[model samples]
Target: MANIIITGTSRGIGFELVKLFAKEGHQVLALSRNVQPVQRLDLSNVHCFSFDLGNPNDFKKVEAFLEQWNVVDVLINNAGSLLNKPFAETTIEEFERVYKVNVFGVAEMIRTVRHKMGKEGHVVTVSSMGGVQGSMKFPGLSAYSSSKGAVITLTELLAEEYKETGPSFNVLALGAVQTEMLEEAFPGYQALVTALEMATYIKDFALTGHKLYNGKLLQVSNSTP
Candidate 1:
């Protein structure tokens, strides 16, 4: 089984992903600010701890874990910070907070893990349809959507920069899924996709998608939210 590292595993798609990988007999390092939810699962193969992307100190914890695990087969940047407010109302501090996690934090995570990743490694960054240029843009997401867009470009650039060394990089521009983040950002909005369904797809892609694709941005969505 592959060694997998997943972020934001407290709930939603991230939480489901931890369960899937662990059940498959893979070694999983689940990262989330609220680790209790995953800790309760008690899976021997799954190790989890409190991880906050915005906290610079949290990266040290990952570095320590890598010392024991050594190599990383897959690293999924699933943690995101969402800010929903009118463009005019959004403050710089608030905007920077979202970017701190969605953009900068992702870059740091990749940097920390790339040394341990070989040619077979895969890094999957979860984005949103809203980040895709020409996708339907919604209001009250200036900071959130823009940060996601930055990540898409970052993934592409890194893929080319590290093309020869391996550990292919990709981004998934997902449509609206019934996640807590979605519910909080857009109240009363119903999504046709479920978190578990998306998590399953992400799992499959993370494991083998690198064979067929590298530096690819897949827009996985039937409907825009």
Candidate 2:
């Protein structure tokens, strides 16, 4: 079984992924600001830790926590932030805040875990298609989208960085998935893919050894299978 690390696991897609991985018999290290109690869960492979991705300093703590452990087989950079404000009304602080969690936080985790990732390991970053081709009518997504773009770029850079390491690295550029984050931003936006499905795809993708997914955008839409 693989040892996996997933961020933003208190709720939404992150939580779904944590459960899914555990169900698949993988050891999961879930990190988020709030961790849900799992007394009802019979799974013995799950471990939760509270972490604020916005704090860049937390990377060291994360590394220290796993320093005594074996290699991590997968790292999912799933935590993200969104601020719904028009460009003219958005501030640098707001933008920076989003970037801190979305971009820098992801990079820090990869950096911290790079050495511990075993051969044929995986790194999946959940990016949005809005960030892939840029958004036109989707206003108020400047900060969020730009941050995703940065993740895509980093995914590409890391793909090359780890090319000779023999790991399956990729970035999943997802379409709208039904989650609390969407409701928080766009009260009633419909989604094409569910969080559970997204998590399943990621888990299976990692096992495929399809390195083309690395450094490329895989948009999840209604037509995606």
Q: What is the total number of backbone clashes in candidate 2? A: 0
Cand. 2 Cα-lDDT: 0.79
Q: State the lDDT at 126 in candidate 1.
A: 98
Residue 55 accuracy (lDDT) in model 1:
91
TM-score of each: 0.99, 0.91
| Ten-residue region with minimum lDDT total, candidate 1 | 62-71
Per-residue CA lDDT of model 1 for 1-225, tens digit only, reads: 999999999999999999999999999999999999999999999998898999999999999989997789999999999998999999999999999999999999999999999999999999999999999999999999999999999999999999999889999999989999999998999999999999999999999999999999999999868
TM-score of 2: 0.91
Clashing pairs in 2: none
lDDT of 2 by residue, 1-225 (tens): 888888988777888888888888888888888775432354678876678889977777788879766888888889899887899999999999999999988988888887887667788888887677644336788899888888988888878877777455688877778888877767777777788887788777765635455556676665311
Runs in model 2 with CA error above 4 Å? Answer: 37-42, 134-137, 209-212, 223-225
Q: Estimate every model's Cα lDDT from 0 to 1.
A: 0.95, 0.79
